[model samples]
Target: MSYNKGWRYIAFLSGFVGLLGVTLYPIAISPMIDASEYKKIQKEARKNIRQEDIQPGNMKVWSDPFGRKKPDSE
Candidate 1:
């Protein structure tokens, strides 16, 4: 049995992409221990909470209407 040249090329490309993702995934999620921006933001948020400036009642619970399945009229 013979396979198309295009199929072989596609299979090779897919394998290459999968391998690339596996190799780079660790590097992607590896956090920068040097950055203090997250710490700063957390500190500011805590300060706001202590001041009661962040109102819970003012926040609206967001919902995705499209997330629920609708019954078919048919």
Candidate 2:
């Protein structure tokens, strides 16, 4: 079925409004938290551990076999 200009205009306007709402929701409404709670979260997020606790990763030693020039023949 073919839609006339009015239906198309309405659909476009509705889509634009929906897009605006989705984009503005996060900016318009943000949650407020206690300073102590925020600090606890920050401290937990920044917790540090000794580097030695983790096992060593793969140690690759690549020797360039073709990079060296050959000695000149006497």
**Number of the top lDDT candidate:** 1
For model 2, how does the per-residue alpha-carbon lDDT over 1-74 read when each residue is reduced to its tens digit? 86548878899889999999888765653324335666798788867853445536643344466789778999
Q: List, residue by residue over 1-74, the lDDT tens digit for candidate 1.
A: 86648878799889999999889765664346444666788898887454344547765455576798777999
**Against the true structure, whose TM-score is highest?**
2
Cα lDDT, all candidates:
0.70, 0.68
lDDT score, candidate 2: 0.68
| Model 1 CA RMSD to the hidden true structure, in angstroms | 12.7
- In model 2, the Cα lDDT at residue 68 comes to 90
TM-score of 1: 0.34
Model 2 stretches with alpha carbons more than 4 Å out: 1-4, 30-74
